[model samples]
Target: METGIRSLRRRWAAPLAALAAWTAAALPVAAIAAQNTITIVVASSPGTGPDILARTVSQQWAAKSGTAAVVDNRPGASGNIGADHVARSRPDGSTLLMAATTFATNAAVNRTLPYDPVKDFAPIALLGTGTLALAVPPSFPAETLKQFVARAKAAPGTINYGSPGNGTPQHLAMELFKQEAHIDLFHVPFKSAGGAVNDLAGGHVSAMIVPLHTIQPLVQGGKLRVLAVMSAERAPSMPQVPTFREEGYDQVQVDVWYGLLAPAGTPDAVVRKLNAEANEALKNKDVVASLAKVGIEPAGGTPARMADTLALELKRWPPVVRAANITAD
Candidate 1:
């Protein structure tokens, strides 16, 4: 009996030893991947809306996934600096890019780009959409959107409007509005939104279109009059305001959205893992509340939907850019 037992133990030992060794080798890899530090690259400077959104979602993702995630600010060349970095990074799940409406806007205006937004990255998830508001000073000559249009036409090229920058979405929105309204307004581009906000509140600028949140405080303080939102409908945060479409200009619906993207060729499983975790993070109550504070509506969707969004934007913005004569500056 003892000899038979020893024979059986010897036969099992080799397979068991091999199994133990395999687990030992795989354990560290699994742990590393699960705990690996991840970075969400924001292609803009700190304190920008996309940077805030990236940091918010990534912090929640880290806490829930047991992995460290951070938003890295890489601002330059209209978000190309950070975007190109992620595009060149290895196809691991460790790095991601904050893909936003500006990415498509940049592509629309600039003919030559360092990387293809669609081909160089995999759309993982959409975090949310940030809406813009169009407003004038409380005492501006125009009381309503139609009146504003009439004023612009009456004094062509004399109305000066401030925006965040030259090629910014705010500037573009006003441009499209001008085109559709058949009016001309002088463009006064600011290096930052705060400057424009101050000028608008002080009545130095005739009109301005900026992020919905940027104008919320001023509008609430009764410093500015919101004419119309550049969306299909009014923002929940400010329902009293009407949409440009509602104001007889339906051609100025511009949506500013932000999404997560992985490097092209990232494994399908890893991409799905990221999408799932991001969606889970978006569902958190605190995350939802934070997005609301910034006037962003949370949008969680499949990778394919995000990809389709980018594809649609690519097709949608070029003609507008050409029509408005927008260019990189």
Candidate 2:
């Protein structure tokens, strides 16, 4: 009887120890789930594109996952402030960055960054892409992209364009357009988009390449005219507008994409959870509508896709920045 009891105890001992180990390993995960409150950091001011996207997605994500979520705007240094905050945050998936096109553009234009765009973050999901349109004051001579190009070529350096600031996507888009069209247009950098658009609508600035929705009000108010959209296809919001490609400037396509990212070393499981939530949020009808209002179309995809997008942006912008001599300051 004693021999049989000893054998049974040995057999049960290993299984009991295994169960205990599994339980110990799972407790932290369970606690994390219970206390999960995601904070999405937007490297821009409130109501900006990135901030809007973050709030729209996070609301749906929180509702779906039963987790609390918030947006923390840290607008400064061309979005590096908020980006650096996320880069240094704990890799527990509780903090994320609502990265915009500047995420890549800043890296390309700036000589040094606080964190490595490629090495410091794990991409979660690509939220959406915003279409860009070339706008001119209603009284400008050019009514079409071809006409605009001809006018610029006829009097190079005479036509001026405005952008929100140096190294912004709008500024870079026009620079790339100038390179492709072989025309020179003076760049008038503004302190903010509001100021730039105000100037553009008031005819103080000749032209600007900004998001379609941004200039929609002015276009509707007859304060500005959209010469051509810089997207590959016509924007759905303004289907009547022609694309640059259609207007014979096939190389002038530029779109601003927004996405989510977490600090490097975040667990695969946590990343997957966040990615799934974000993708789902993109599919929500309300989310789609809200983004569409801002000229953004949903572009939900895998983390790998986001990584590829960032890699491509990083590669694509350096040449343009170099050619344009764009600097963050």
Global lDDT of each model?
A: 0.85, 0.89
Which residue runs does candidate 1 get wrong by more than 4 Å?
Answer: 1-35
Candidate 1 at 147: error in angstroms?
0.8
Model 1 lDDT tens row, 1-329? 99999999999999999999887655543543665688889999888889889988878977887778877999998889999999999677788999888888888888899998888999999889877777899889777888898888898999999987867777877887888889999988888889998999999999988888877888889999988888777888888888888887777888789999989977777788888988999999999999899878889989998998889888877776888787788
In angstroms, give how far residue 280 of model 2 lies from its true place: 1.1
Best by lDDT: 2
What would the per-residue lDDT of candidate 2 be over residues 120-203, giving only the tens digit for each residue? Answer: 999999989998989999889987888899999999899999999999989998898899889999999999999999999999
How close is every model to the real structure, measured as TM-score? 0.88, 0.90
Worst 10 residues of 1 by lDDT: 24-33
Residue 204 lDDT, candidate 1, scale 0-100? 94
Whole-model lDDT for model 2 versus the true structure?
0.89
